[model samples]
Target: MLALQPVDTVAPAFRPEPVTQEEAAAMFRAALGLFGKWELTDDQAATLLDMPVRTYRRWKAEGPGRISRDGCARLSNLMGIHKALRIIFAEARRGYGWIKAGNDAFAGSSALDVMLGGELTDLMRVRRYLDATRGGW
Candidate 1:
């Protein structure tokens, strides 16, 4: 008869600390120094970025390779608004439920127009309206 071996499982310890700009520069330099030494999985890459599987799929379908935080979020928001507006316009033309849908389509702009004198486009229209009407938010 042969003796059975027991499995040993232990998780690695990690500590988190805020990185200053100088620390960030040095850390990135050190990490980059070990290029092609460590092997990483596709799942590991996605997991490291905290991306959802579905979001990763859509992004990969668009183009291969890594995606940036700001660019991806901005593109996703624009695409969502575009699709919604298309549906709203189609429904409005067919004479269905335009009253509520149209009301808040441009909440910031409409509110700004209501108050008047928002010549500058750089400013947040809703915030500008609030500043003009009330003190400030």
Candidate 2:
């Protein structure tokens, strides 16, 4: 609250600033880039998109079978990979920072083992086979 000094008292007032079109586009780009860094959380994503969280939430809940066009490239790319991996390992057990399975579909020896265990020998074997076929070995 401000004490009333009365109008025409010869005091300068604070004025709000506005953005031009180019500036607005630049801001949109920056906001979208921020959306890519974090894990998929609705409110956080909305904040990155520069929308009020509740407004974003409402739009999402509408269930129109669509996502907004503002998803940044990094977010899209990571989400695509995550979805693909889920489909590939649908039957695999997940826990302790990795998923492992009987057939080891991902890393071919339980996901956790390959992820944490530096199994270069296993990697080399797979690479060797591919190399032989490609005539690069």
Q: By lDDT, who's the top model here?
A: 2
In model 2, which runs have C-alpha deviations exceeding 4 angstroms?
A: 1-41, 45-51, 63-69, 72-75, 87-137
The models' CA-based lDDT, in order, is 0.35, 0.40
lDDT (Cα, 0-100) at 124 in candidate 1: 35
Please give the lDDT score for candidate 2: 0.40
Worst 10 residues of 2 by lDDT: 91-100
TM-score of 2: 0.26
Per-residue CA lDDT of candidate 2, range 35-129, in tens?
33322366655543335678656655552222333333222332333333434445423311132343334435643233223233433343343
lDDT of 1 by residue, 14-124 (tens): 875544445433433332221112222334323422456565455445443343443333233323322343344455333222211333535534421321231223123
As for model 2, its CA RMSD to the true structure in angstroms is 19.7
Taking all chains together, each candidate's TM-score versus the true structure is 0.23, 0.26
Q: How does model 1 score by TM-score?
A: 0.23
Error of 1 at 120 (Å): 19
